[model samples]
Target: MGFREYRGSRQHTHAHFVLTGHTSFEDEPPLLEELGINFDHITQKTMTVLNPTKETDASILGDGDLAGPLVFCLMFGSCLLLGGKVHFGYIYGIGGIGCVSLWCLLNMMSLTGVSVWTVASILGYCLLPMVFLSGASIILSLQGVLGQILATLSVGWCSLSASKLFVSALAMHDQQLLVAYPCALLYGVFALLTIF
Candidate 1:
């Protein structure tokens, strides 16, 4: 995806939800038959650290080759620069996401079955909700304790939104919370920082 500065009227956005959904599937999700990721199950399986699926044809992390995470970085930076309501360093907006993303991508391997690419891609795709929440927090001009509270709540939303897919992609169950815990902390820190 290319990034273009909008000269037109900007109402702001859900292509994000669709795009994120694109990252979740190994092959063209039924909804996106025309222009969607064609996750190659055969190639992807060879790349994963673990495959809990009995079916070898299942879509794993490397199945799809779209660069959703890279697009997200640009979106985040752009939102911070454009949103205007966030009254802090632009680095805070952009860099906070990077930091949280890095932490999750790195620590996610502690679980039994996960791939670095999948973790990064999932977190990258997951950036949609986090960025939107931050944008909303800034756009609404939330601050002080109330701001912190709302920011933290947004983190919860990201965690919940991401958990289902993360669990599925990693083929984890029963102990999914173990995987989710790190995400909670990363979100907690970044979400609170948005208030400051």
Candidate 2:
């Protein structure tokens, strides 16, 4: 027997890649945008993760909020548990909270223009370091307080790097980093709690 079909329309010959898992930040908004407030543009931009000006808008974080981070966390957290940290979930959870907080703070501070997506972009990309911090905290546990600080520092440094790109994109004064550093520190504290 053969899998043959007589298609009456062009649609019958076409396959939806999304149904087969080829979907990415690039494809979700159009298909799932109707599902809710889809921020596809914002989410895709996060993949690049730079915002150098006030006009750098990252508010369109795509359709599924869980889409990007879930893949990242699963891989990182599983590695941590394999390395013997049974509390790996804490890393995943705290990283998520930090991104949400980043989004909220950017909106409140009036540092960004346009919609809330730009912050989403910044945090989404920044979370990559948080994943590393999770692994570092687990591996560096033998180093005590110094290792913990270093791991947290990695997360903070990541945020600062993103902030610098964001400042450049937004064309803001370099002094705006005074605001950026504390925000990054707050994100670091969230990551810090995971290790300690």
Candidate 3:
């Protein structure tokens, strides 16, 4: 009888909830709101990509976020696919190599080292212009003068924005052009991928 009472007391003690009010289902955020916040975050990052001259917040740029970049890469590849090109392998290969190379180069160049994921994130974010260029290729032939112009503009935009973000995040004020040179090369590859 005593052992049964002791067992009952043990069960009663273990059954109580440790978390009270905060664990309630009503406090959880709705799905749409969470999605909206994520969208807003992506938009802000894109805005940073678009505006090269504007000072970028290091926190935003240095978080080493990859979701935006992954989406951009997939979008770029998909746009190319839609345009009758199956260069997904080339895209992924170049992106991975470029990010690693840039990470190494930036770490060597800057006092503040950079993360590979950050390099990838910046490269991916900068691909926005490339995405548009790839999309434009779908609608019209990108071999003409107008296509050349668009491709040039897109490459320049991506390169400048990427270099600017890197310089800003790494605090390499004087080496913006130096940073831009390699960025131009990287984005130039994407431009070729779009054109051919």
Candidate 4:
């Protein structure tokens, strides 16, 4: 029978039928997968951030992701908030401006230029140390000698991690120091934010 004839015959049957294997039926992914938070990816990035001298896998760091960065930035802001410093706006604002500035600077300095998002991701991932420093400030006043030392170390950690990633991703082996100087300056700003 023709489709039209079958439909006409079923007109008196007001019920609707849907096939389980219909084209419209789709299996949704699990919540974790849908959220795009790859634990493995974040773990690798975090490890690299912790160990600044370690060589990063280009394929991993080159694939820019903002999830870890967003978490670190938020953590830094939250820790600062807990420490009685409400600098969420400064955190995000400095982060955005710093990422753009680094993106521009690195592009000019490297043969294989990078995108702003990639720069942002790398910088954001490196912010983990700063986040920790911010968290520490909650229990200890950062205006003293010990606090200054910790803040300096954290800034170095962030700068080294970010510079290493940027250099490896962009193949700027000869210009590591050049890349690191700006990274240090940027992270120094973040350190200043964490301190005062």
What TM-score, computed on C-alpha atoms, does each candidate reach? 0.53, 0.52, 0.81, 0.84
lDDT value for candidate 3? 0.87
- Mind giving the per-residue lDDT tens digits that candidate 3 earns over 1-196? 3555444444323225344434456887887565433666677789988887776887777666677888999999999999999999999999888888889999999998888878988899999999999999999899989989999999999999999889888999889899999999999999999998
Candidate lDDT (C-alpha), each: 0.54, 0.55, 0.87, 0.87
Task: Please write out the lDDT profile of model 4 over residues 27-132, one tens digit for every residue.
Answer: 6566768776788988999999998777688888776789999999999999999988899998899889999999999989888879898899999999999999
Q: List the residue pairs that clash in candidate 1.
A: 26-39
Off by over 4 Å in 4: 1-36
* Range of the 10 consecutive residues with the lowest summed lDDT in candidate 4: 12-21
The CA lDDT at 186 in model 1 is 62
Query: How much is 84 displaced in model 2, in angstroms?
Result: 4.9
lDDT of 1 by residue, 1-196 (tens): 9998878785424786566565445654475445445444323432231222333333544334335555655665566556553434543454456545644554564355454556656555555655665677546766666666677666766565455446665555664576566666666655654554
